[model samples]
Target: MNDFTPSRRSFLAGSAAAGASLVIGLNAKGALAAGHDGALVPNPFVKIAPDGTVTVIIKHFEMGQGTTTGLATLVAEEMDADWDALQIEFAPADASKYANTLFGMQGTGGSTAMANSYMQYRQAGAAARAMLMEAASLEWAVRASEITIDKGVVRHGDVSAGFGELVGKVKETAEPPSEPILKEPKDFKLIGQDLLPRKDTPAKTDGTAIFAMDVAPEGAIYAVMARAPRFGGTVASLDDSAALEVPGVSAVKETPKGVVVYATDTWAAMQGRDALSIEWDFSNAEGRSTEEMEAEYAAALDGDGPVARDDAGVAEALETGTAVEAEFDFPFLAHAPMETMNCVVQAKDGKVHIWDGSQFPTVTQMAVGAVTGVGPENTSIETVYAGGSFGRRANMDSDYHVEAAMAAIALGTDQPVKLVWTREDDVRGGYYRPMVKHRVKMAVGADGKLAAWQSDVASKSIFTGTPMEEMIVHDGVDHSTVEGVSDTQYAIPAMKVSVRNMETPVPVLWWRSVGHSHSGYAMEVAMDMAAEAAGADPVAFREELLAGSPRLLGVLKLAAEKAGWGNDLPDGWGRGVAVHPSFNSYVAQVAEVSTDADGRVKLERIVAAVDCGVAVNPDVIRAQVEGAIGYGLSHAMRQKITLDSGEVVQSNFPDYEPLRINDMPKIEVHIVASAEAPTGIGEPGLPPAAPAVANAIFAATGKRIMRLPMVDAGVEFA
Candidate 1:
C-alpha cells in the first residue's frame, strides 16, 4: 500500500521547501521545540498546513480499538479546530519522541494509549493554537489575549482570517509557548460529544486504509516457515530437494526458529513449505498434556507460595469463622485476531525498513537492527492499521519481526521479504494467556459479614524470563500473575494472597485485562458465595463492603439499577452481577441468563456501567465496552488452547470457536459522568464480564462452574 500519512509526502516536503505552513514540535518533557531550519522542527506529532488541515501524529497502533479517533479528538477539542479538517497519522519508530511514559518504551498495550498521551497531545494542540493566535495578533495589530480561534478561524473584533491564511506569519514571527493554557472541560465542544465521526471510519469503510497485509513492495518475496509442531523443538535436519522443485520456489534456509521457504508469492511459498521435509528434535520440548499440567497446577495451590499480599490475622480468622471455599480453573487462550501475524522487511546498505502493524516500534527496530547489522538509528518502521491484537503483536522479543529480518539477511540479497503466518500458524503459535488455577477460602465473621479472604493462585509467569522481568517482577512475585487479587477494590478487612509461578515450556503473555481475566472471576464468584453465606442480597453485600471505594460502588449500583436487579425474571432466568477495577478504570456488569432443561445457558442481556473518568468519546467507549463483552464471552464460553502431548489440539475457528453472532446478548452500556482525567477503557470492560455470566449461571442452575471454557465443565452457552 502507498504511504497514507502526509508526514513523508507533504509535511517533510513543506519543511524542506519552506512552504507556507506552521510546524510546532514538542520536546521529551512536552515543552515546545524548534522545527527544521531554525524554525520549529516538524515533531511529526502536530502539523498545520496552508489549506487549514491539522494532522496529529499518533504513537499508538489502531487495532479496531478506536485509539486513533480517541487521540485525534484530544487535538481537535483543545485546538478549537474544525473536526472535518482533522487528520491522524501513525508515528514513525522514534522512541525518543514517542515512548510511552508508563513503560519508558515506545509501545501500545495495557490500554495505556489514552491515559499516557492524553496531556501530551492536548498540550500539542494548545501550543499550536497559541502560535496561531500570536500570528493573528501580529497581523491584526492586536494583543494576543484579544485574539480568539474557533473552528479553524481566528478573529479579533471585526478582523477575521482562516488558520490557513496565518500559516506563513506563524512560521516567520510567532513564538512557540512552553506552557499553553488548556480549555476546561466545561468549554469542550468535541471531547464528550457522541455524534462526532471517527477519522478512520471513512478510509476503513472505503477499503482504502492500509493494513500490514495489504503492503507488497515492488520486488518483495513471500516467506513461509515450517516450525516445530511442539514448543521448544528446533530443526534437526531438512531436505529441500522437493521444495526447490516447486514452481516459483527460490530458496530454502534454516533459522533458529524453523526452516523458511522463500517464493515469488504467498501461494508458492506455502506450497514449497508443504513440500519440504524436516526432522524435529524434542529434547527440550514440552511433552506433557493439558490434563497433566492442570493436575500439577492444582497441586501447587496446596502449598504456601510467595506472599503477594497479606493483611493481619487471616489464618486465625478463617479457622474461627465460617469458611466458604471454591476453586476456579482457567485454560490457556489464543489471541486469534482477524488478521494474522505478518510483516514486510527490507535490509540494504546497512539500513532496515519495516512495514507492519507495529505495536512496539522501538523494540521492532532494535530487534531487526541487531539481526541486519544496522544500528537503531538506521532502522525505520512504518506503522499500519491492525485488524485486531488483543495482546499479540507487542511481543517483548519482537518474534515475527526478527524472523523476517533473519530471513532477509539469510537471502543475502536486496529483495524485500514479507513474512506471513497462516491461520494455523497463528492459532498454534504460543505466547498464550497462561493457564491458571485459583483456590479461595472466604470466612464470614460472627456478625454475618465478609471477614477474611485468602487466595492461592498458581500460573505460569508472563514476565519472569522476558525483558520486563526487572520491571514487572518484584520481591519474587510476578505482579501480573496476581493483579486483581492483590490490588482488589473491595474492602476486605483481613486478606492474604499468595502466588506460585509454575515453570513450563509453554510460552505465556498478557491477554486482555491480564491477570484480572482469571483473578476477577475468582474474586467475584467468591463474593457471591460469601453473600449467600451471610444471607444477604449479593448487591447489598457488595455495596456494604465497597463503602470506601466510591467509583467501584458507583458502577455496581448503576449496573444493578440499570439491569433491574430486584425485578422478578422468568422461572428459569436469573440475574448476576460483578464489579472490577483494572487499568485505573472501574466497570460493573450484570448478566441476565436462562438455562434449558439440558443445562444449556442462554445469555439474554448484559448491562454494563463504567466510570473511566471523563469519557473522551462516549460513542467509542460504548463500542469498546460492547466489543469487550463479546470478546470476553467468546473465551469464557468456548475458546481455549489445549495441548495433547505438546501439540495444539485445535487449529482454526471451526474447532476453536468464537462467539457466534446469533448467540450475542443484548448489551447496554452506561457511562458515569465525571470531570477527572480519562482512564483506559480497552481492557477494563472485559475482566468483569465472565464473572458476571458465571455468577448468573450459578443463580439459574445452582451449579458452580469451577472450570473455564464452559464446554469443559459440562456447561454450554447458546
Candidate 2:
C-alpha cells in the first residue's frame, strides 16, 4: 500500500524516499496540518499519480464485507475517476484523520462502514474533483464553470486535458476550494452499477491480500500465547526451561495475562508453547460454570428486571385471554472467525507500529500504545484486510492486540513480533455473544388480532462493565439485550419488553447483528406460534401487524411471493416465513424444510428479500445475504460455547461446529430497488434467517422449538 492521498487533500507525488516525494498531512476535518518540520502535513485519502493511477485509502477494514470496493465506487462515481485507474490501500491508524463518523472512532463495526462513510467518502471525492476544477480554472484561465470534468478528463471547448496532466496543477502549492460541488444521484456514473468487479476479489483470489497473519515485518518473530484456560485467569507462574530449549525458540516471556513463546515460525512457536508447563491457578477464575449461569438466567427470568418498553393494557389483555408462552435458552456463541486473532507489533524509541486486521483501529492504537508506554500519537497502525470478522475483531477490550503489544514490550523493542492464536485458542477464548434466555408470552383475542406481548430477556450484559456501560445502559437495563423486542415491528395493542442483565463472569461481546441474534429468533418464531394459534397464514398475520411499516411489509410480501408461500410441497415438507427490521434495513426470509423419518430437519432452500435502500453493488449485497444466511444457520443449527467449572468445553471446529459449505442451503436473494440512501447491509440479513428455519421446522413437524442450536430440538441435514 503506497501511502498517498491527493484527493481528500492536496496529494503529493514522488518516490518512496521521504526526501524524494512531496509530503502533506491533513486533520480529520479534511484540512491540512503541519508536519514536524513546519511544512504542510497532508491528510490524504486518495492519491492520483501523474501516471493516472488512482488509489483510495480505505478507512474501514475489509472484513469480507466488500466494503473496500463498495467505498471505492462511491469515490469513483462522484469524481468521474476512471475505474481502470483505481487501486486500494489500508489507511494508517490516526483517529483524528479517519474516525468513523458514526462512532467518532477509527473502526468498522455496527455495519456502519458504508452507512457512515457513504456521504463522507463521496464528499472526499467531490471535494477532490472540485480541487481539480479549481486547478484547471487557474491553469487554462477559464471560469470554473467553463471547466467540465468527465471520465478523468477536463475539457474546455477544443482545449482538453486528461486528469493525469491536470492533476499536477493541484501541486503541493495549490489550495482546494472551501466548498466543492457534489453530484446528484440521477447523474451518477458508476454508483449503483454492478458491472465493475469487486476490487478486493482479484487480490484475494490471487492470494496477495494482506491479512494480519500474513504481515511479517523485518526480523519478525512468531509468538503463541499460552493463555489461561479460564477467563480472567493470569499467568500465575511458568516454567519455560523446556520451551527455551526447543528448536528455533528464542524466548518464553510472561505477559500480564499469558505466556508468549517467541520462535522463528508459527509451528515452532506452537511447539515451544506446547513444551512449556506452568502452575495451574483457578482461584481467580472469573466465570461460573455454564450450568450455574443458566440457572441464574432462568431465575432472573422468573424474577423481575429492568423494563425497556411498556404500554397500557398488557396486564389486562394477557390476564383475561388465552396465551402461548415459550422459554428459549440460547447459549453463548463464539465469533470463531476463520482467521484466528493475530496482531503484529514492533516498538522503537517510544514509538510503536501495529499491523492488525482490527475492527477498531483507533482503539487498537490507543490500547497498544498504552500497553507499550508509547501513547496513541506515537503509535502507527495499519489496518489490513481481515480473513473474517463477524464481530470478533471489534472488541472493546482490544484483547488480542493488547496482548501482542505486551509480548512486544517483554521482548524489549526492536524485536517485531507476530502474536497468533490457533483455532483451538480462539474457540476457547472468551468475549462470546452473551449467554441468554428469552421467556416470551404472547396473547391473541378471539377477533384474531394480537392483544398483548411480553418478553423477558436474561443475559450477560455486553456493556455492563465495559467503558461503554454508562453511555448505553440505563436504570439497570442494557439495550443490547432488548433491542429487537423493545422496538419490535409488530403493531400489538399492548407490549412490554424487559431485560435481566444477569451478571456473569463469562466474557461477552457483540456478535453479528448483536441483540438481534437471539431476540430475532425469539420474536419472529413466537409470532409464528401466535399465527398458528390464531389459525392465520403466517405471512398475512405479519402483514396485519406491520401496517405502520410499509417497507418491512413490502419485503415480507416480496419474500413470500418469491418463495411461493401458498404452494403445496411434498409430504413432511413445509414452508415458513419471518420478517424483522434492524440496523435501519428491512429483511424478510422464507425457509423450506423437511423432517426425515429419523426426526432430522433438513433445510432445502431460503428465499430472502432485503430493502437496504440504494444498492452500491448488487453482487456484494447478494454475497452479504448469502454469507449472513450461512452464519446464522450455523448458530441456529448447533453452535454453542459451554463452560464447565469456568473452562470452555468446546475447543475447535470438531466440537464448536461451523456450517460447512456443503451443508449450506440454497439461498435466493432479492434486493428491493430503491432510490433512497443506503443503510446497513452487513448484519440485517442474519436475524430473520434463524426464525425462518425454526418456523419451517415447526410447520413440518408441529414442534415448537424455542431454543438456540435448534439442532438441540432434533434438527439436522442428512
List the candidates' TM-scores in order.
Answer: 0.94, 0.93
lDDT of 1 by residue, 1-718 (tens): 1101122232222223222222233433323333333333224467777776777888888999998998889888888989887788898877666777676667899989888888877877887788788778878889989888789888999889886677767644335566779998889999999967988999999999999999999999999989899998988889999999999999999987688899999999999999998999989999889999999998888887899899998989999999999999999999889999999999888799999999987767666766677866799998999999899888776788888888888888787899999989988974799999999999999898988999999999998866667678888889999998888878898999999889878878889889998898899988999999999999999999899999999999999999999999999888899999999999999999998887679999999999998888999999999999999999999999999999899899998899999878999999999988889999999989998998899999997778888888888765
- RMSD (CA, Å), candidate 1 to true, equals 5.6
**Which 10 consecutive positions of candidate 1 have the poorest summed lDDT?**
1-10
Off by over 4 Å in 1: 1-43, 171-173
What lDDT is obtained when candidate 1 is compared to the true structure?
A: 0.85
lDDT, each prediction: 0.85, 0.81
* Best model number under lDDT: 1
Please, what are the lDDT tens digits per residue for candidate 2 over residues 686-716? 9999999888888888887877787777666
User: Model 1 residue 65 lDDT?
Assistant: 90
The parts of candidate 2 lying over 4 Å away from their true place are 1-43, 141-143, 171-174, 286-288
Clashing pairs in 1: 34-40, 34-41, 35-39, 35-40, 35-41, 36-41
